[model samples]
Target: MTDIGIVGAGAAAAAATYVIDGALPDASITVFEKSGGLCGRAATRRRGDVTYDYGANYLKDDDDRVVDLVSTFDDGLVEVAGDIHVFDRSGTVSEGRDADERKWTYRTGLTRLAKHLFGATDATVHRRTRVERIARSDGAWTLTDDDGGTRGPFDVLLLNPPAPQTATLLETADWDAAARDDLLAATRDVDYRTVWTAVLGYPFELDRPYYALVNTDKEHDVGWVAREECKPGHVPDGESVLVVQANHEWSVERYDADPARNVADLADHAAALLDDERLADPAWTDHQGWRYALPESGLRRGARTPAEDAGCYVLGDWVAGEARLHAAVRNGLDTGERIVHAR
Candidate 1:
């Protein structure tokens, strides 16, 4: 039987797990996720009667294969309502920038995408188990977690954490030193944009023409502001939830600042852009800081060949050269196929 090990339970990892489990029915698959959550930055949270996707706004219908994959389990799928409008650094809103494709999320939230994929697999997933070390011995891979526990001695290993985190693991791994160094250098070269997000809940409804606003030039302090109420079943009737994300520069500056102050500042930006005073003081607030939020660039071509040759694969949107959620799933599907064929 094929023995497989995977790290991270993001969308890509979940998709890979599903594919691998189906292809190799006798495979013993294991996964370790650092957080209690799945789907990485496509995260969601609920408070009282409201559910919001505070990380990735929505999944874009850009990839045909991913669209087909998601369509197989079409339950709870909901389209995000309204057009996307553009905003300039001066806070001027425009009507020209509507989406060319559809935006989608589940009635529950985006995390359901990962859940549906993983639920079909027999892979044993260990959540809140952070894999702190990686080692290769006896032609097998093993992992050491934060709690001093070890897992593996598997024939194949898949590293699915962000490039930086994956790089750190590779740098300290006990494996073929030359191959590890090559992978480590490629992983470390990937740069990311940080994002600090604030979710504001208002008791009153917000009347707006667009579901979301984007900073086209990337010069604005607030990067993107999305209306959570536009998604079906996300918010209660006559109430609203706004997700405000600060730009990379702004996020880096206040990433270590007080949470209350960051929320207040982001709320002020939202109020100014929306031209509504009530937004300046939200009824309730929530916030998240993503240090390696969006990958600015991907790894060099064929840089992972050495590792892949040794039954080690790294998959994600960054590895696919696209920062979209669909790209990550597409990469995952392809990676799973590769592993199956290799066996």
Candidate 2:
């Protein structure tokens, strides 16, 4: 029987382990991941000889905890000077001081960051395990898998799943009326926007700026166009990779449409913005949808009832601030510290 059981293998869970291990050295830790791999939204995909960051793009230096954690890894990350180009609806590219701020990305891909977090600890990470329900019985917490298999009577249980999915899990578990109401109340007001990322790879370079942050008045959206070659180890000398993020409004309008057609249309729109018609055709192209891409509101109140008296905690970017990668990591570290202090 493990002392602590965590749901999800994202940064939050990894940070929780880092905290719990130090606080409760004798306790065993186990993390259950629904997917076949770790890194929930921080996903990376490889195409032929190039790797693409399909999920998170980069991290800000202002995030202290995140910076410290990332520094622990030896992966090559080039410092990005804010020399970004912001294109408005009129096709006017404005140059500003905002481009001078520093950012960072992996030389290979975002997966290197996930692997670094996982390597920091010895937590028992179980991939491909879908946690269906979490309940407290006989003074201990029981987590059930999809097949109704009971995992254990864990002393503590931490839930870090996305807010929408977390609501479903809380509904299945037996809890006091007030506790359930509080959990529901805290999450009810939180809304999220969906993001559609269209990734494409080409054998030739488009002789424009490396990054184009576009604001479209027609769609009232923000599209982030990044040159993959700007990062290290992405492609060969002449080839380049590009990623376009559709604005919230545009993504919502076509959230349920055919993915291929949606990607084609988005690619066309992006190509028009860049004045490069060649982008319509690429050697490789794909689209990924993020349902809960950004958090609408911050978490209302602290203190979540963790499976009866098991003393589990809840934390995520929603609780800290926006749904940025840095915020998530900060929330995770904070949750870990709180758990440790409680112990």
Candidate 3:
């Protein structure tokens, strides 16, 4: 029987788990996630009866494989129907070009994607277990956790962290020094766009023609503003929840600032761009800081060669060269199939 271990519980990891489980049903799979929640940056949260996807706005129907995979989980899927308006540098809002395509999320939340993928497999996911180190011996990999516990002897290992974090892991891994150094060099140069997201809720409905507003020129402080009401069952009939994501520059500037202050600033920006004043005051607010939001570059060609040759694999949206959820899922599916064939 094959023994497979995966690090991080993001979209790619979930997709990989789903594919690997289907291809190799007899394999023993184990996953380690540092955080309490799954799906990484494609995060979702609920406040009282209102559910919202605060990180990734929604998954697009860009890949046929992803479409087929999600189709199998019809009970958890919810298609979003609305237009996305663009806010130019001058603060004028217009309809966006991509709104013609369909957007999707889960009925419960985006996390259901991860839940459904993992639920289909016999894999055991260990949440809140941060892997501190990875080493190889006897053609097997051993993982050490931050809690001083060790788990390992797996035939294969998969890493699903962001590029920078993955670089750190490669740097500390007790593997071939030259290969590790090469991977570190390549991954270190994979730049990322940081984002600070704020979720605001109101007791009354927000009447707007568009469901979202994005910064087309990238000159605005807010990168995107989306309404939770666009997704069915996310918001109460009479209430609304607005998710505001700050641009890279603004997010980097205020990432360490007070959450209340940062959220207020985003709400203020949203009010101006949406031409609505009531949005400046939200009944409840939630905030999250994504240090590594989207990857600016894909994985270097030579970066994965060394790992793959050593029975290790790296998968993520960053590795796929596109930060979209569809890209990540596609990469994971491809990587899982490659692993299955390789074995």
- For all candidates, what are the clash counts? 0, 2, 0
Q: Write model 3 residue lDDT over 59-102, tens digit each, in one string.
A: 99998889998899878688986888888878898767775788
TM-score of candidate 2 against the unseen true structure: 0.91
Between candidates 2 and 3, name the one with more favorable TM-score: 3
Question: Tens-digit lDDT track for model 2 on 25-139?
Answer: 7878888889886666777778777877777776666677788887877568766433577777665556533555566777667666656776767678888899999887665
List, residue by residue over 1-343, the lDDT tens digit for candidate 1: 9999999999899889989999999999998999999898899999988999988888888889999999987899999999999999899999847466799999889999999998898888899999999999988899999999889889999999989999989988988657788888988999999999999999999999999999999999999999999999899999999999999999999999999999999999999999999999999999999998898888888888888888789999888878889888999999999999999
Worst 10 residues of 3 by lDDT: 175-184
Put the candidates in TM-score order, highest first: 1, 3, 2
The whole-model lDDT of each prediction reads 0.91, 0.73, 0.90
Report residue 31 deviation for candidate 2 (angstroms). Answer: 0.8
Q: Native-vs-model 3 lDDT?
A: 0.90
Error of 2 at 35 (Å): 1.3
Clashing residue pairs for model 1 = none
